[model samples]
Target chain A: MRIKELFINNFRNYKSLHIKPKENLNIFIGDNAQGKTNILEAICFLLQGRSFRTSHEKEIINFDSEQSKLKTELKAYNQNYSIDISLSRTKPKIIKINNSTTSKPELATNFGTIVFTPDQLSIIKGSPKERRRFLDLELASFYPQYKYYFVNYQKVLLQRNNLLKELKEKKQADTFDLLELWDNQLISYGAKILMARMEILKKLIPMAQQIHNQITSDKEKLTIRYRSSLNLNSNFREELIYDQFREVILKNRQQDYLKGQTTVGPHRDDLVFLINNKNITDFGSQGQQRTIILTLKFAIINLWSCELNDVPVLLLDDVFFELDSKRQKYIFDLLNKDVQVFITSTGMANTEKNLINIKKNAIFNVRSGLVCEEEL
Target chain B: MRIKELFINNFRNYKSLHIKPKENLNIFIGDNAQGKTNILEAICFLLQGRSFRTSHEKEIINFDSEQSKLKTELKAYNQNYSIDISLSRTKPKIIKINNSTTSKPELATNFGTIVFTPDQLSIIKGSPKERRRFLDLELASFYPQYKYYFVNYQKVLLQRNNLLKELKEKKQADTFDLLELWDNQLISYGAKILMARMEILKKLIPMAQQIHNQITSDKEKLTIRYRSSLNLNSNFREELIYDQFREVILKNRQQDYLKGQTTVGPHRDDLVFLINNKNITDFGSQGQQRTIILTLKFAIINLWSCELNDVPVLLLDDVFFELDSKRQKYIFDLLNKDVQVFITSTGMANTEKNLINIKKNAIFNVRSGLVCEEEL
Candidate 1:
């Protein structure tokens, strides 16, 4: 799977851009804010139908423009894909595939993209929200239906929490039955999300462990456990999980109503990485944690290749400079020549000098939101 | 200033450890949670009589222990300083300099330590609170009196906000005068904090700009503008800034009263980085933003060397891998051999290989909350 061409207009700092990127490594070289990340965001917009930078659509539009458009031509699975995104300040994003209008998030199932930034490297040491987001995005990218269930779960959770808040406001002690309807919907959707996420972890762990061992030279072993609030006991039967979820909700509903918040679900789930039975979050050095994220990212690549029957195009924001040259070499070695990777860097000299394995590469200089192709 | 020896007992995951560290470069090699950071934390404890990792002293104590002790022997400017800290589960941290007990924060002025982690690299792109904390800490470190005034400002701000809330709740127009007393205190303390921060940033920008230029190879020029809610424009007068701050507070107090939150003052301030007049916060590439942070951190080093007449003991928590080897070479070239530097890494090979300029070095392998010295 590769993006052959990309068109970006009024999207961030970019006024207009049309580029035919390299098949192996497309390097966008520019100083800070020269619209380098914008290209990655444009490709990501075509793949995921939204910018990873911000949820506010207005922020994506060029300052003087009311709307922005991103289009891409890609080859995936021996077929061509053309995806378009129309972003407007006052309205929601409009996504289209093959000239037919479609929902934004619906693109996740058909298109696969894996992005890595410095922020993701530190996600292991960050709050629970960061790890949960990692799980949700990967699952949605792997299995598109997972997004539907996860979205539904969030909706039900919000509505249920609102009802809980109202119950608290009214000081009602006997409003137990009021939660049943929301509770059932919550369990139904939440259980699917749980199973999907658990399945992803199952597939992800072995790959991560292998990569981590390779990185550590087998001196340290890596293991990841899905720390779920649902207390899933390897009994992946949906009915059993739902039954247990329902019971847990019932048991915590009084406290939930008093606090006016949802207390349990996939939202509270965590991914804990252990290196030889030692928890990395509490014990891992910065380099070790970064290696863990690197393993997880590579696992995503392998996971896509095996199960999804499609390879993900890698969109790396500063992978060249953020990583040491040795790690950069390792990553390039991990990626085969057939994989299309778009990398953003501040300068092209370092990329060319360090990434010795790249037989084909394209460089572009960006300034004041404009991109111009350059050849070495 | 250099740490000659460090004593650690019952701190973080460590039980008891005594290590004679080298003055130039000491490398801690370990997998995650092997008490590598605890060593740095103990040194930081000695310097500032507190842990940068946590606010609660009890949290530093080992689980089974009720107390922790950190002592350091240091040599600076033809003088020797022995700093001691007594940490307990039930009380505040006790700091003794030359065996005379002093407040923990008082150590900030005389003791200089500059730390860089993967976390600090992204601080510019994080929340406003993160930046504010950065300012507060640096200022407190540069001028310890700044902490005294800033804490007073916070107390007054809380009291003033509470009074505003009470005035709104009671619907009493006559209570506006009740805020006058708190307002004066808020203005006085707030003005001092604002001035102190402005002074530090004023000293920082040129240094950061020069280093950023060097890092980007003169392709990009960096500038930092202090963004304050008071709309300050280079006027360093405390009384004038205070007058403007007071007027702004009065104008916004009604809205503040209704919202039950303070809307003005240092709480809402920000540091905006611009590359050739382009806002880097919104526009900087991940690499460029990191370069900016790296420049800022080195500028801190230069700033301390010039003003304080004391070169700090550099406590780098895995900056080697966080930055590429090429950039690591740049940093090593930037530092002088006279400064004491402690770096933590997961392996010995990367440290010895990347840090090529070191003539003498110490390696310590950490495991299961213990540190054992190793010969490189």
Candidate 2:
């Protein structure tokens, strides 16, 4: 999917902005704080119904303004589409697709984008939650149904926790029965999630290995493993669906009460990173960790492309400057003539030759929240 | 920050994968359970020396493997650079910049990125913690010093908590002195964090408001308020240094004992989002919540770009189809021509023309762990 045009009014530093994109390469060049990233953020907002930066919606509006508006035109699979989002102070934002109201799922069916930034580098050095997020998102994109399951599972988890809290406060004897009901629901949904995660991991491992080999010049091997709290033994499917540990559940009740939280289940499960039988989190060096993450991401891209039958857009923030020549060339070569790429840099001089070779690319100048197109 | 080339081996799925990118648009498409997202994740790893996806490094290696390796050849500011990362079963990942080892801070300085994904939508609908993460990350990206402050503050917080736990368990009076010392450290660093956060918010509010207006079609006004547990009257900033809080801290000793944990401080503070004098979290519709998050991200991008003198790359993972056409167009128009763009879609059928028009764009066909170039 590719974006055609973007319009912004009172969004970030841009009071009113309009931009028409080049068919191939589009570059945004500017000094710091010129709102260069804001332009990309605006596009992200329109595509995802969210931003890549902050979490508060109010931050998008001008300090003195009450609302912000964004409009974009897109062309995907030989189709032209437009999306509009209005940020307001008193009500939920309004979203329109092709001049019609739509839900997030419906929107998911129309537009698809992949963004990369420096913060993502943490996928290598950061905590496990970040990795899980990466997996969950990729899964959600390819399997919209996974989004529903994820949301539903989270909702169920929250409700169950709430119920646990209530039971603790009330000091009720029936808490166990109530907990069982919730537990049943949780397990049902949780099982699906666990299975899905396992399945994805299973499929991802070999692909990641292949990518890792190419990136490393065949020096090492890579592996990804899913570690869950539930013991996957006996009749796997039957145990998940029918087996119950009433005693264990009851035993943890008091602990749950004292903690004011549920302490076990899929929520607590984690994905363990192992290299040749050793855990990466406990022993891996910084560089090793970085390679593992890189391999994992490449694996995801390859796996997703394979699954969806099309290439996803590639967004690289300031990462290019961070890599050495060999690694850099590896990534550069991957850009081949197929993927639509977006990169942000302080100056055009900072871009690589391949990145600068876009004859049909559009270049824009961003300064203090204003964006103006520039001739290459 | 544009990627010149990427190479991967035994990371997750690919035993070996190599690709050369188009200067402009590069797309990686695949089916469900494929590894498309993994590819971008690998780039993130190279950039941050960490994974944006998981906490465990070993998980990145392909299952049944002992190690993973990643190499990248990067060109930034017309300079060629290389990065190599090695993941092993028994040691921490290794990072080599131009074949020389470097620290994380140095790496961060060289490579900075901004990532976006659909899960970010939760920043709108999820809890305050999610929002705080959004802010902290933005801060870390623009102000690398903030990362240090954050790390120090966290360490102090953990130490303080540990002291509190000791006090509760030992019921010793002398522990108070030690507690006081930790508290002092906490306040000293905490103050810096508080100040930085406040300053960032101050600069961010105006931009956010403007963006919110555009996204909301000028229907709503948005504001972000930082809520700290400490009473920071002018004198309090000076008076409440760890030493000053001795008495109050002592008074809370009993409660701390009862809780067995630290109960007060900025760590527990929250950021409040308001729209027209109402808290959006409690009252805003789903769409509004999403818009608020979108606005916040835009604000972050603007703030970071302005502060860092560079535009961070934008990462959007399958977020587009979530917004309506108008909103989509808003985003499409917002990606300034100079910014490099990357996006992922299930199929080309849903893509926009502008996205398709990028001069050097390439589309890759991905299927079940295999990636092949799609003729444009």
Top TM-score model: 1
Evaluated with DockQ, which candidate comes out highest? 1
Docking quality level of the chain pair in candidate 2: incorrect
Give TM-scores of chain A for all candidates.
Answer: 0.85, 0.79
Backbone clashes under 3 angstroms, per model = 4, 290
Query: Per-residue lDDT tens digits of candidate 1, residues B100-198?
Result: 898865686678687776678657788878888887877776786887898888898889888877787688756677878988888888889988988
Runs of candidate 1 with Cα error greater than 4 angstroms are A4-42, A54-73, A82-103, A319-334, A337-376, B4-43, B50-73, B83-103, B163-181, B210-219, B318-334, B337-376
Which portions of model 2 show Cα errors greater than 4 Å? A22-25, A121-126, A155-178, A233-264, A274-298, A347-351, A360-365, A370-376, B1-376
By summed lDDT, the worst window of 10 consecutive residues in model 1 chain B runs over: B349-358
Best by lDDT: 1
Q: Which lDDT tens digits does candidate 2 get at residues B17-64?
A: 777665555566654335666676777788778876677788788776
**Alpha carbon lDDT of residue B107, candidate 2?**
79
Candidate 1 docks with a DockQ of 0.24
Give all TM-scores, in the order shown: 0.80, 0.52
Cα lDDT tens digits, model 2, A173-221, are: 4656777777777766766766677667767888887776776566555
- Give Cα distance to truth, residue B237, candidate 1, Å: 2.6
Error of 2 at B239 (Å): 8.7
